[model samples]
Target chain A: GAGVSQSPRYKVAKRGQDVALRCDPISGHVSLFWYQQALGQGPEFLTYFQNEAQLDKSGLPSDRFFAERPEGSVSTLKIQRTQQEDSAVYLCASSESGRSYNEQFFGPGTRLTVL
Target chain B: GESVGLHLPTLSVQEGDNSIINCAYSNSASDYFIWYKQESGKGPQFIIDIRSNMDKRQGQRVTVLLNKTVKHLSLQIAATQPGDSAVYFCAERGKGAQKLVFGQGTRLTINP
Candidate 1:
């Protein structure tokens, strides 16, 4: 079975530019999550979606970070006015259900480099 | 203020030897813990998980031990192989929380 997939494995952006990262979760997965991982650090949760509903966005660092899963299958994370501090790998994951105990299948993240 | 942290930044073990990675979490409300392995240029891969109610759980060659009283967790891998060389992370999910708090990660090197 195909696992989660993300686009633009690497991206370079100028300061103040906006960037968008996409994620395709596994087929029939009901839960999706986004996380940000800085260099040499573990991933930190960014947002979560259960189907098309955006349940939690607490981990998003700032208002510039926005995410949506409008169709319930694909999700996107967008950062406005990118900054050096926003440079990190954005990871996407999905699980069979919304329960915390379920194993989350992750995708090869998109590494964003802000200059 | 809540965070998961690793005691060691790196660990090196010989091939066929066992390896242990330790983690400490500050949140006492954490009820679910998971271990993940990550290679260069990839996302974290789910290794194993254990709940607070259970003291230990095993899967394949990996075992996860959770000590709620001490707010500690550990992951043990038997017969470490070259393929096991990567960064390992411990994550915790607090009760009623949807997000997972991850540790800094411990780099494991397997010397053959």
Candidate 2:
């Protein structure tokens, strides 16, 4: 794909169910980011990955949220024991360089609904 | 107090009219600012970027103006068209990490 791609455009999970969201960044991109967006709010940074390293997880809200990028190309964000507040859109973005200033391309995002 | 838009600020202009969207950031050390457009059901797409060094930067049909003193930013779109209708967001990257703090956003509705 010419741009970033994500999986499970829509998901419905029970309050205690676990869900995993996938992100395939643009080929050769060195920076990958995950953000969580609530209804009518802008995306909030969750984590940042530089290649295969999880450089920043300071934005992760709780222990239930975890993300990994072992190969440096693709990443996964997992949420365990989801709660109603977990219902929001998860957005993935990638940049060519792992620098401080770079243009990021985003995916369609996954809309998660917790019941 | 948390920053949330009580009502989405809207800009309605006729086709071909130039449009300006404004944003106010709180962080003082922000050195990088970016403008993104997000359509319904889609994530934000990078439109243009501006560094704090210069006050103004221009792209194809867009111009970004940054004022560090007042912590204000604005995106100016030239020759607005129906296809340009979307929500615009301004983000600031603070010192250290590249995490962006986005604004409340303004809805641009190009009336044809």
Best by DockQ: 1
lDDT of candidate 1 over A1-115, digit per residue (tens):
7999999899999999999999999999999999999999999999999999999999999999999999999999999999999999999999999977788899999999999
Q: What is every candidate's alpha-carbon RMSD to the true fold?
A: 0.8, 2.0
Best candidate according to lDDT: 1
Model 1 local distance difference test score: 0.95
Clashing residue pairs in candidate 2 (N, C-alpha, C atoms within 3 angstroms) = none
> Candidate 2's chain A scores what TM-score?
0.98
TM-score of model 1 relative to the true fold?
A: 0.98
Specify the highest-TM-score model's number. 1
Backbone clashes (count) for model 1: 0
Prediction 2 global C-alpha lDDT: 0.88
Instruction: Kindly list the per-residue Cα lDDT of model 2 for residues A1-115, writing each as its tens digit.
Output: 5788899999999999999999999999999999998887788889999999998998899999999999889999999999999999999999988788888889999999999
TM-score of each: 0.98, 0.94
Supply candidate 1's per-residue lDDT for A19. Answer: 97
Error of 1 at A19 (Å): 0.7
In the predicted model 1, the residue pairs found to clash are: none
Q: What share of the true interface contacts does candidate 1 keep?
A: 0.80
